[model samples]
Target: VKQIGNTHNREMLPSCWDLTEAVIRHLLNMTDKEFFYWGEYLNEKAKQRQTQYKGPHQVFQENV
Candidate 1:
């Protein structure tokens, strides 16, 4: 896991794991209003990048 994380630019893997858990906990504790706000924010961001985004399979094939 550490090796993969390093390859993916995760300089501080240990801290990343802790932060991930914290984010999960925060998400789980979010009120409905907070959750919906984040959901819409993410949706808007995704839409803005939809044209430039590529799936993992496409990226892998290009690299291969």
Candidate 2:
């Protein structure tokens, strides 16, 4: 295993698989309201950027 930071902000991931596993675990742990809020935040941010760069408002919930 490798530690990525100091004690106050450390991450211990043994492999690349651990990174994905941690990400999925965190996402799955969010409440319905939190997830919706996160999606809305992302969409709004994307919309702000869309004015300057044409692209999709990539949502994180549906794909997860």
* Predicted model with the maximum lDDT: 1
> Candidate 2 residues 15-40, lDDT tens each?
67888899899989999999999999
lDDT of 1 at 17: 73
Query: Model 1 scores what on Cα lDDT?
Result: 0.79
Evaluate candidate 1 by giving its C-alpha RMSD to the native, one decimal: 11.3
**Model 1, range 1-64, lDDT digits (tens) per residue?**
3454346555535577788999999999999999999999998887667547777865675679
Angstrom error of the Cα, residue 21, model 2: value is 1.4
Residue 61 local lDDT, model 1: 58
lDDT score of residue 58 within candidate 2: 37
Worst 10 residues of 2 by lDDT: 54-63
